[model samples]
Target: MKKLSNTVLATACCYSSLVAAQTTNLNEILVTASRTAQSVDETLASVTLITRKDIERSQAITVADILQKTPGVMITNRGGIGKSSSIFLRGTSSKNSLIVIDGIRVGSATLGQVSVEELNLSQIERIEIVRGPRSSLYGSDAAGGVIQIFTRRGAGRLTPSFTISAGSDGTSLAEVGLQGGDQNRWFNVTASGITTDGFDAKTTGNIDDDGYHNQGLHLRLGQRFDGGHELEGFFSITDSESEYDDFSSDRSDTLTKVMGASGTFAVSDMWLVNVSAGRSWNKTKAFSGSAFKSRHETVRDSFTIQNDLLISDDNQLIFGLDYINDQIDTNNAYVVTDRNNWAGFAQYQLTLGKSDLQFSARVDDNEQFGSYTTGGIAWGIPLNNNLKLVTSYGTAFKAPSFNDLYYPSDAYGGGNADLVPEESDTFELSLRGKYQDVNWQASLYQTTFKDMIAWAPSPTVLYPYRWLPSNINSARIRGLELSADYQWQQWLLSGNLSFLDPEVRSGANKGNRLARRADRILNLNLDRNFGALTLGATLHAEGRRYTSDSNTSSLEGFGTVDLRATYQLAPAWQVRAKLSNLLDKQYQTISGYNQAGSTALFTLAYQPQ
Candidate 1:
């Protein structure tokens, strides 16, 4: 076997593979990029799809690990696995993206983020990541993009599967699942547990060993009637406990629950109606040794109704109404505990000759911020047999969280109730093509923000300045992304690169890069198959990033490699092994935080073929 440099491998592999199409085509269908089903190549937005086979092959334990390999995406983890993780998309803030599970929003409204670190990959069937603003369809918290996770459902005949794995750091994992379905009915159930005595999170601080444990359960059911009516429902829950070093040997317990039900009916030949309702709950409690310190909980309930109408063979329209209520519960007192929002949206899609056009608009009414409107337009033009051009313009906004509006006002810096919503306008242009067995996409984008929120010293205070949340900043973000994949007879190669410039345009911190956002990122993966054995390797490289707005503290760039192998023991069983951080590279995504060292895992899986 011979090894080649990333640049050389990418170029040579892509050029050589452009001879013919393979017997197996993996053209994926996506729904998160738009609210409708469309092939990946036909969607106008930058998107990435992770399927079940990819997950099993990579042997990723959490959703964060999978997302780190995607283009135009960055993650900042406070420590090792199961720690607090922040996601940055296309130079946008951590809270600017929306997360959905089975068509239902799931996250903490008070923090304006989701616990992607806690999401078990064993229960997920697919994940769709759409980059760029999407508020015209999702309403709020979509200034960056949207990530939707689809749980595993029943398919084909009855099947049972199980997996067991153990590795370094006292880590162990076990999972079992059963799925079955007929033409009219289907059901799936899964259970998983993972535990690890992780490494110290702080490099130079306390010597206590932080550890994490989690247990998860998931269930899905669906039914189909004779009159073009279908019903589906799902429920998933995860409970976890993690220890970390702060002021003391502190620990926290986290519980997350998501449940939803949906129905689709064909009202007529040209009209189809869909209705859904769901709820998500996120709760956490902190403890110092034997004493309970504090607790916080957020609950969100949502309802939606949509209608799709076909005007002609080339024209289609979709209209929908959405309602959401967010409530917070905490041991400490606060001024406000709940809020509500209602929205109405419509979209029109048209296909003319070699052009595809889509127009969308939304109107949202919030209890605290009154009414706001947003809109977007996207166009795709086919330039030749294998090339296409896409362009889009859209506007988005983010509402302030509960803690940002109603914190205590006594000794600490008080919250500001008059804060307006953060807003942005974005424009993007992309080129996509498929030549022989090589597929590639390149995109350029820019976004301008207004009324961005930040915690800064109050200007009115004279001596002792109090830091308060205020709309005191604006930003300008621009970036370029390129991704390519090539598949040959028994080998597959893929790579992606990103360049970003995220600046605070109008503020005291002007000309400074955003915190924890790297200016350059590159990722590459290569895999080969021989008989019953498969081998894979991955490389990840990231550039330097600042830790604060002043650029005083920084993290140096680093690169790491990973290796994996899988062998088919029999028709119904398989064995797999993975080595992470093969070079044992020492680096940090956040200042003072320690990452994992070299680790290995061996897994055995059983499934009926």
Candidate 2:
């Protein structure tokens, strides 16, 4: 079955490639790749930019839903909307990627993964995704890449908006927001709520329906002074409750909060300074029937200061310092509960003739693991009038999480404080071109990993039969990515394809495919606009993947199609409808987990004219 699907996809790609070969140009501005605003074509790394208009046109309800269609990205969920989810980038593990919310790192210290499922798309204005190693500019946990989300910002005159939606399975949504700003001052506030009586999450065992509820709030305020100084404050929070089927518990509640303040000053004509501080908090509680099971909480406090200097018309330099403190509180006993880390980094950019070069280095000092250094260099060459070639080499690392070193010895397993961080080196080459009405990019990359951490039986004589976390494996990952877009008059088409080979290089599981990472993925979208009405369709597909490192179980490949349409009812009102999983295909990304089937939603929105 998978082979047949692959053949069909290949044929489609060939047809689309011929149609998209004609020439086109796209000029998008992004910031996550270099920490500075620049044109997408000028950056040395592969990137994707999602704007507010794109979000609205897609009618996506969550961040994960929007990212699932992006190149070099794959998302896996255990169940419906508010369930546990994981994202893999370029064949790297979820923890290898960094998640930044308004320039602040947000994740759990113990699990070492971000809860992107809880993030509200209604409060986000833009998202920038950089697909490559980035530990040189950032401190750690960037072996895969970086994803930065920007909250809603006010612009121009005052505007107020609201949206109401109702759909299948007792699903409903409501959102309201107000944004306004002048030349010197700006503010934005938004609140939203979602509820759904979803399908069962498990295949067998429990047949009862599960339900989820979520609420989110976002606020932002900023002011610019006359002396080239600016100040800003922002806050975001999400509260959710979900019910699922488990041996001990069937319910859980989670609360996530993030807040920060920042200031920017222009000290001189050639120098600029920026400083910021922020905090992220996550709390979860589990229950078994009517009795309490357990509770866990993680909090992170972070600070950053940076300086940018213009040395010459074609040369620029940037330096920064970062500090982070992580604390964990839980009902289970552990060896340690807190830690701190600090780092300093510098970057240089230079341009000469038709070539651009970038270099960056960083040094990190952790309270538990002394010091480590990482760096990278990249070069971009203009091959012709409309074609360019870019290559880069970089080193990245992932720090050991608290659960890897501090978990108490028990029947399940014990943490090993002697465990070291995982490190990797990557080399990449890419070609980008633009021809009349089409734009395209292709990239090839390879990564070698060392000191990879895993949980297995202890080798020491002291605990021979017990399972413990250790550095027991190594891996080599290679992949190819191709993406293209073509626009003509009122019609636009875009698509992406990725092929990955993620394998354990040396271990008992050597030569085996990594768990939950698919070898092939494809995405396609087409949209057309006529007068005040628009229509769009999307197709997403992935190949079979293993469910465990041993490759004992697997899930079959599947594809899904979605349709959307929007019509303007008045100057200040609009209506939208979406039909997901139109074929009602039955498939699962995980061995025992259940995925949502056919669903539909309709929304009405109002805006002041």
Candidate 3:
């Protein structure tokens, strides 16, 4: 694998016995890249897709479990299931990434990040991950990238699915779902529950087992009207409690909800229009030893109107307008708790001979800040029959979160209201091609961030030592990514590798590395089908990373292996088993936080054929 390429960074082994399709299918259509449908090979964006079959076959319990294996994606969790989790795409901060479910942006406005650990995979049908800045399409938080999740939808005749699982540490899961559809209408509904008595989350904390439980429901409905028009609605909710080893058996209860509706109209042969609106809420309550600590709730509302026009067979245009409002309600009082933003964007795509070009730009008027504009251009050049090169340049910006502006003064630290938005520019180049039974991609990219936020010590007369948030540092990051997929007969082999260098360019810690971002990551997967049984194995490894901006404490790198098998009992019933961390390797992505050890789980599932 070392001979493949120094900059090549991924090995995705998802498609073997789970489904017959190969990972390298160029015809797969994508919607998140440009807010419109386009084939994978035709879109000039780095993208990865995960299907429902892959999720089922992998037996992953959480959405983060599946996303961590993709190309140029990294995940860091504080502890076991339901604990705090964060994502870093290409050495960027967690706040730089955006998470979308059913086209509705969802996260916490106070914390400036999503609770990805709470999202269960049973209700998701597909996922699309686009790497690189997408602020030209989505407003803020898309400076790193965008991950769009599509929930289950009905298609054919009525069908029912039931699944149950039991595992080590008193872990259990159960889910039931029903879906039906006809030519004119479709609907899907699901209910699920999962609980686990997890291991201790910290090495030096109280010696007691932590635990987590979650309950969820999902529903989707769609109808096709006359004249090629369509209307759709979606609703999802999750309630969960997670206990960890912190302030005397500390725990938190969270309720997350998202709902949305959309209407699409085909105005003419060359014109299309879409109108959509959605809202999301994040509510959390904390407790310490049966005593209520605090409560914080975040709400987000979004609306959009878009038009797609086809000028010719080789040219297309898309323009859209978006309005967003965010509010926060917390037990701790703050001076300001709400803000609004309005934005307009347009994109153009053109093809000439063997060349492809795309231009996009957007302007956002934020209530907190004045106005910011972002733009991007991507070009594809044909090097030969088997290979193509892509080059792109983009600029992105991120607005400060509520906590960064108005957290209310505290003894330890306080927010700064005069801080400005952080900005960045990126340049990328890649080569992609297919040979024989193998498909591969290699790329290099660089990004520079200006006016980045940092927390620094601010001494006061009363409080000798204190900290405050300020726009102090700038950063430069350079990275390489490589991916390849191969299929031969009934076997599949896929892998990914990423190498990154993230450094503070203009600060006291000038040459120091960013916190919690591993410089090296590698993953490989292989699987085969035999008779009525299928077997697969995965290997994942990471390099050491710092835990503080000053690079005092660091986490050591470690590797783990996972094994899985599926057995068919009948055409509609099946049994599956998985052993994670087979070697019982002890490691931590966050200092003092303990990761899961070796564990086994068995599952029984039934679905109509």
**Which window of 10 residues has the lowest lDDT sum in candidate 2?**
14-23
Write one digit per residue (lDDT tens) for candidate 1, span 429-529: 99988889988899999988998776654545442545578775688889999999988989989899999998888777888887788999999999999
Q: Which candidate has the top score in TM-score?
A: 3
Candidate 1 residue pairs in clash (backbone atoms < 3 Å): none
CA lDDT of each candidate? 0.84, 0.84, 0.85
- Which parts of model 2 are misplaced by more than 4 Å? 1-26, 409-414, 455-468
Query: On residues 1-609, what C-alpha lDDT tens digit does candidate 2 reach at each position?
Result: 001112222222221111111122244556577765455777889898888778888898779999989999999987888888888999897888899988888998987879878888988987889999999988788989999888887766899999999998889999999989886788889999999998998887779888899999999888877656778889999999998886557999999999988877767656667788999999999998889987889999999998767676567677999999999999988688998999999988778777988899999998888798999999999899789999999999888888888877765566888989999999999998988778899999998899877665454565454667777568888999999998899998999999999888887888998778888999999999987999999999999999867788899999999999999999989999999888998888877889889899999999664
Which structure is stronger by TM-score: 1 or 3?
Answer: 3
Residue 145 of model 3 has an lDDT of 91
Error of 3 at 481 (Å): 0.4
Q: Give the backbone clash total of model 3.
A: 12
lDDT of 3 by residue, 1-609 (tens): 001111101100111011223355876767788887766787788898888877877788888889988888889987888899889999887888889987888899988878998887888988889999999989899888999888888767999999999999899999999999876788889999999999898887689888999999999988877766778899999999998876333899999999999877778766778788999999999999789988999999999998877676678788999999999999998778999999999999888788988899999999989799999999988788778899999999999899888877766677888889999999999999989888889989998999877666677897654778888569988999999989999898999999999998877788998788898999999889896898999999999899877898899888999999999999989999999999999999888889999999999999875
Q: Which ten-residue region of model 1 has the weakest summed lDDT? A: 1-10
